[model samples]
Target chain A: MAAAVETASHIRAARRGSIRGSRRKALFWSYFFLVLFVVIFLAPPFYMLITSLKSSGEISAQVNPWWVFHPTLENYLGLLTEPNFVTFFRNSAVVSLCVVAISMLISVPAAFALARMKFWGSATLATGVFLTYLIPESLLFIPFFRIFAFLRDITGIEFLNHWWVLIIVYPTLSVPFCTWILISYFASIPKELDEAALIDGAGYIQMLTKIFIPVALPGIIAATIFAFTVAWADFLYPLAFTTSADQLVLPVGIVTTLIKGDVYNWGQIMAGSLICAAPPLIIYAFLMDYYIAGLTAGATKG
Target chain B: MAEAVMSGVRAPAARRSSLRAIARRKPMIAFMMALPLILLILLLVVYPALYSIHLATLNRSMKRFVGFGNFLFLFKRDTFWMVVKQSVIFACTAVFFKTLIGIFLANFVHTIPTKGQRKWRGMLMVSWVIPTAISSITWFWLFDPSYSAFNWLLAKFFGTAPIPWLGEPLWARFCVILVNIWAGTPFFMIMYLAALKSVPEQLYEAAAIDGANWWQRLWYVTLPMMRNIISITVLFSLIVTFANFDIVRILTNGGPVDQTQIFATWAFQVGIQGNDIPLGASVSLFMFPILGVSAYFILRGVRRRSQEI
Candidate 1:
């Protein structure tokens, strides 16, 4: 009881003294590290920007490396005009967008059911869904490759080196995690809200469309962003599956097309790497709150 | 008291619920909602995982059953055990540093003012959100032998020759670990920071009033409060790092005499590069024990925590 009284008084004193001498020191330290941390985090992309602005001769000059003699936008313009780079970006965008759409269609309702419903195997299935997220794509790639080969044999339609191949593969990553988060977010909502809607003679589909989706907008956005970023930035699947220039995603295309046999085009490679990283970086910079919310949703549920 | 009486008056008229109507219909609705998820898991996840098991057992490359020959062949290889050792080393070391650094960073971030805290929080999360493949490419450039900025900086600062980050065996392993730490630690930091916020301020205030030093307060109050969270985060990191593929793949491609090869990359090499699918399956199967143990602990921890709550 004395400890409790002392604690209450101490808290009051701390609140009173928050504007006093030692607090400023703490504030300064916090801001100082915050700035330093920001710089450390942001430096690589800054270095990439500088590298992208330099010419190949400048980049490899063996002189003072940090400063460019002649800053040029030539690499950026040249890369934009490069026929294969454009195709790669377009293919990546299309594949990523389609994967997002597909993941949402499957995951949102499934997450809702697991979160809100009580079925015989619902809980077990939820765990099963999360376990799929844990299966590394590296392990699955060879089997998937063989399955595609078999598909070609039976259907006389080749799935290899096709952009649409990702539409089939990307779901393997997105759905499980998306379902997991959606389930968590869905569970947090009050049951009475849904019950009221049900009592109003709203069908399951209508209630989902009208209520749950709107309420869970942040979680949905997080899942969509995750799917887009994963599909956009995937390397192994594209490296293993797609052989053609036209079919490649940004990550694989930049590496394969730019790096020739025993020779590295340092300028174009850095430039392409920067370009590929930009969208996700920009999105992350702006939408970090929603992203963190989405990420920790799983931790809470698990 | 007045509001309680008012609500009680309205409660009786709203009690027209039929038990059978509610019980039978709700189960049907729940099942209907869950159908797509069940089908997807069965078709996509269960089938593929089970199919891989069957593939692991047999040597049916040309529709022929070679029995346990694949496992026998894998057991006889020298590199298989080396890969296992390296994977455990990589996962343990990376998870250890990531969890430690993450906790420290989270504590540092948590003590800051709210307005400043959010900005730093967002900045730190960039490492986690910047698609792993794209950032791995950037790291590849940093470790590039000829024109790497990191090597350039190291040379300028230390007055030493440029380090062959990707070409040397031990250095290549270290570089991958560094890159993995860079990419992964933010995930733990965020989780810990969220856990930190849930801790009540009164606990700290009480410790302060008792004349406990900062370290003692942390040991007594913070550690006890965040212990479960720390374990969960570490276990999660262990599973992820054990199965990691992209960073090692992009950075080294498991080269420099295969010095840095972990299980996933080794599996890829054997299966895809060496054209030995059965051997690859055996190598990939090695990941099961690590994941299985971590998953069991995580689930049990989760259950204990849930029951406590």
Candidate 2:
């Protein structure tokens, strides 16, 4: 009996040891692949930084493209001082900010009503909102272009070529998604808190401001980040709508102005691209948790 | 005392009437709250979507109705068919690889210690956070035939010849799809990671107790648990990828004999740049059927998931 018991214990110990061994192997492989992916993923941006640091002459020279020998900030300074680049930056900022504000104003109240208030067709309306998000901006830009022209013909408002047209156009891109995110978020807020507020005679608007908004602040932040990113990063709308250098947003402006008719300005382009990419990247770095939460919530929670 | 009694009687009646009025007005109030959203959707999304269909029916100059004429014209054109074929290939290939890579990376990230996962995830997510337009510019420069950085690296280390990345048709298609995968995988990874975390740990522990190997556990436990998320992400990615514009437009501009033209770019080329608004509208409208089908599945999934919750 004693010998048998000892053998069983030894077997269990061996199994545990093998398990540990496999786990360690798994971990090692995980880290190896993780590092590899990170490198591949980061290579372009890293290359961008490397290229942005090099001078035009160095960029042209047949040497290691990855390494910058005589690093310079001339690209950065040139873009910053250039009026077109500055205008592009300003236009992007204004458009994105305005879109974010409009999106919130439109989506928040709508989300609240859909999530909490059982209005007529609220459920169908809620589903409609999600379905609307599935519609890509590429599909809409064509009609919008013509519509602007039609409007200009009728009202004499030059809606097609102006930067401000983007502020109107971008919300259609943003509102649906924002409303969807906020719906799920506001839905997730428990019934009791709102019930108590209702019992206390708080108005719908008051309850939203005091209760739901505060509780769902993280979701709000996430939605805001998404809105801002969409507005700031959108290429199609700006590319199609606003053509002139002064009216162009960052993405369109950088591509059109910096490329400049077959003579690709690599140094200045990289610098401008990097600078254009900064706001969204910076926002992501700071609010990554909210951003990820918002992203996952779309599929998982919704 | 008589005046106080009269006032008290009126107060209850007034309060009760107000309560009833509020109950009656609740739907109106909700409608009022959602009015801006309703109007925006009606005027912007729904109106433009329907307007595109009407626009597609018209002639280039918007004077004549040519129902199915544009589509018939597209049917005859080799480039239109190529756009369809390329769009399918591009969307399917990119989404497939993205889902595969996303799942693998999610699993790998999940294997690491909890403390280290955030750092790894953050680093991996950088590619996605950078705007596609800007990232595509970097990719364009990287793929420049004369000074392709990737070619230089390969030539330096592996003694390979420089590649005509955007100069050749097949290579341009590959480059555009590759960039799409790079830009998109992080989103899939992040989504799958969240799904992975939500899977109950006990299922894996139980599987281990059953003497199931790691692959069995992953196939049985992990994949099954993540089915809903996988489907949703894939479907969503499909729609986005099918309609993708920035990478292709910026990287190749449907060049190398227009081999890389997808619907969005082709639509832009035909409708806007080519100065045929009706045809462009028709080209873009081709995206609707596929988008509609996918959007249907997605809605059903979301509805089911919401119900389950």
Candidate 3:
């Protein structure tokens, strides 16, 4: 009986050990892939950073490519101090800020109305807003170019090559998504809060400013972040409409100005790209929750 | 006392009547509130969309009527056929890889304890947060000849010859799609993770209690619960990916015999640069049918989602 008891305990111990061993093996594979994915996802930017730190002469030399033999910050300094680069930076900043403001101004109230108020065609209008967001820039740029010219002829607005022209055009991209996100956000707000305000004879504007806006603050921040990113990162419109260096945004500016006659000033080029990327990256780093909320809400919440 | 009572009764009734008036005028109020956004959309989105169709019908100079002529011209060209095939391939491949890898990564991330998930997700989304132009151009530099990091790494491990990453037609197309997958997959990961969270834990527990294995639980419970989100995300991604311009434009610009040309870049090349507006407009219109289908699905998904909530 003692031997049988001992044998039974041994078998149970072995079974538990095997289960633990299998879990360990599963965890090992999971981390292995996780590390591998981190490297793959991060390699390009990491490489870009290393490349940016290397001097041009070092880059072209037959030397170790991964590590910087001779590091320098000339690329960053040079690009930053350059006049055209400054202009591009300024244009991107201005356009992004104004677009954020415009998108919020337009979307917040519209979303509130759609979410809270009962009106004819509201549902259809909501769908329309979504569909408009889906209409890609590629489809619009062509007609937009032609229309800009037509407007130039009729309205005397020199929109074809102006930096300010982007302000008018970018709302098309930002407003629909902003409105959609805001609508979902507004709808999700507890109806009781706003309903109580309504019962107290509060005006819609008062209810919006005093109640809905404060409650839906996270949603508003997400929308603003989204609009800012969209406007700042827009490459095609800047590339198409703005021909002169002075009018270019950072993306178009770097690509066009840095590459000159078959030679890529790669150090400076990578530096410019990284510099342009820093704003959004920094924003993402700090406000990741809001950013992710916006991204997922922009798609799934709708 | 009587006067005070009369005043009190009159005040509440008067306030109630005013509230009624406000509610009655809510339609006009809503309409007025929505007016600026409506006008903005009507001007920018609606007008331009209709204008694009009209532009497609016009000749290059915008003076002549050529209904269906430009589109017919496109149908006859070998390049147009290639563009159509290539666009479909690019969008479909990118979307497929993104969705698959996204689910995998999302599942992996989901497996971790909640505290670790955010850190891992932030790291993964690095590519997505960076502007596409910057990242795509970064890939362009990485894939540059004479010192391609990828080729060097490939040679190190696989002992292969230098890859013409953006030089060869097949590799160029593959590179573009790979970049799209890289940048796009994180979005799917986050969205899928959100969708996955909505799946009730009890379902999985019940499935396990019933002898359903890991795969079975995922297939029956997780996927079915996530169907709405999956469809919506894929549909939205399809539209975006189909109309994707930044990756192809920055990476190859439809070079190496225009092998990676999609509608956006092709339209830019032919219409804006080549000064053939009609052809460009016609090229861009090819995207509408596909997008229309995707949008329809997305709207349906949104409606269903809102209804559920």
Candidate 4:
């Protein structure tokens, strides 16, 4: 009777074991595809890295394109030492920084007022802010040309090709979206904190500067990062306006300078792109939480 | 402590005005705060947009008034029709694939253990972190005819002939759309993952207890939960993808007999490069109607949510 009971218990244990084994198999397959996608997603940038490490002569038709035979710092160093690389880097840095500052200055208070303060047409204006974010830069550059010409016709400030003009044009893109994102963010904060201050006899300006701005810092960081990335990554405006090499931003500068006259310097071109991509990549790497928070908040809520 | 608190309390009677006075002041205060932003939008966006419409009405030299003349000329061109078709195909196909692949990838990543989730998310987001122009440049080299990495692999493994990724017309369009999907999929992945996280775990457990299978649970619970996010993400991506210029410009530049030209590039070519600003403005203005419809929905959503707040 004891042996029979033991055998029955053993059978139950074996059945449970098989179910666990199947679950393990399911997980193995799931991870298999996950790693597969990781490789696929990473391939292009990985290819750039390997190609950038290779010697110029080694990137020919016959060589194995997968690995670098003679890994060298030439591509990266050569890019840095290129005549206008420093200028491009500096220009991008200045523009991105200035755009971020300008975007924050304009967007923060506006978003606060729109989110919290009641006014006639504030809702309409908030909707309009979101609408402007939808307007593509593609439509704007043509009119930018005409507008600059019109400015030249009147104010005589030939706005085209001037690097600072981007400082002006980029805010149109950044402000509406940044303000929209902040509106959502500022709206998310509990009303009692500010209401408490209002009861404490805090004036509106004091509440905004001392309370709202301090509280909405995360959204501000997100907007700053977004504006910086847009400024750094912008191609068309710089391309359309800034033809001179010194005035160009990194993305535009790298393309026009590195890929010259059909004799493509694949090595330097790859390296240049990698460098051009570095600022945003570094910001994304370090502050990914804030970045995603901003993107989704801007999308889902705003 | 009582004295300190009392000092703070006494200021309200001196500072807190009556309700009607505060109500009167609120609009004035809000308007003052919003003035800088409003001025920036008007000067940069509204004024320039109005100027584009005016420019579209004039001749090439900006000297003659020619109503609908630029639009008439664009309608007559075969290339313009080609751009219209290609733009639609590119935006639709790219957005569709990105959404599909994003859902799959997001679901897969969501199922993994929490410890591994953050690392994988960071890795996946790297694609989006890199600028599109930079990544597209990398792809341009990968699609290079002679030293193409993709071709080299196909030849080595499958004994396939060298494929001209950017040389032929169809392949060129494919290359541009493919790069767009690669860059954009990460965005959808992360956003959907966030939405997936918000789904109540109890609902899934309840569905399972009711004997619903995986597909049934996804259909009945997950899809219903994620409906709003899916539509908005699609609309947002559609506008951006439809107006895309960088990837195509870098990869193909409307080449192989203008088969790949979208409105943006074609406009840049004619208006900026070809020195016909009026025609270019007209081409860009065509994007407004399609995008205006999409924007209306998004703005309505934003306005509704703000009202809720």
Best by lDDT: 2
TM-score-better candidate, 1 vs 4: 4
Worst 10 residues of 3 chain A by lDDT: A18-27
Error of 4 at B231 (Å): 0.3
lDDT of 1 by residue, B84-128 (tens): 778888999999999887887787798787877887887887777
CAPRI band for model 4 = acceptable
Candidate 3 residue A50 Cα shift, in angstroms, is 1.0
Candidate 4 Cα outliers beyond 4 Å, as residue runs: A1-26, B1-24, B301-309
TM-score of chain A, every prediction, order shown: 0.89, 0.98, 0.92, 0.90
RMSD of each: 5.3, 5.7, 5.7, 5.2
Q: Local error of candidate 4 at B253, Å?
A: 0.4
Candidate 1 backbone collisions, by pair: none
- Which ten contiguous residues of candidate 1 chain B have the minimum total lDDT? B1-10
lDDT of each: 0.77, 0.89, 0.86, 0.84
Q: Which ten residues in a row have the lowest lDDT in candidate 4 chain A?
A: A18-27
Q: Write model 3 residue lDDT over A1-302, tens digit each, in one string.
A: 99999999998788667655654664566567767888899988888899889889988886667779889999989987899899999999998999999999999999888777756777678777888899999999988998898889998878888998899999999999898888877777766676678778788899899988998898998898899999999988988899988988999998889897788899999988888999999988998898678777766665
Question: What TM-score does structure 1 among the candidates reach?
Answer: 0.91
Error of 3 at A259 (Å): 0.9
Candidate 2: misplaced stretches above 4 Å? Answer: B1-19
Candidate 3 residue A233 Cα shift, in angstroms, is: 0.7
Against the native complex, each candidate's DockQ, computed on alpha carbons, is 0.37, 0.54, 0.46, 0.47
- Candidate 1 residue lDDT tens string, A194-244: 767767766668878999899989999888888888888787788778988
True contacts kept of 4: 0.61
Give candidate 3 misplaced runs (Cα > 4 Å): A1-25, B1-15, B209-213
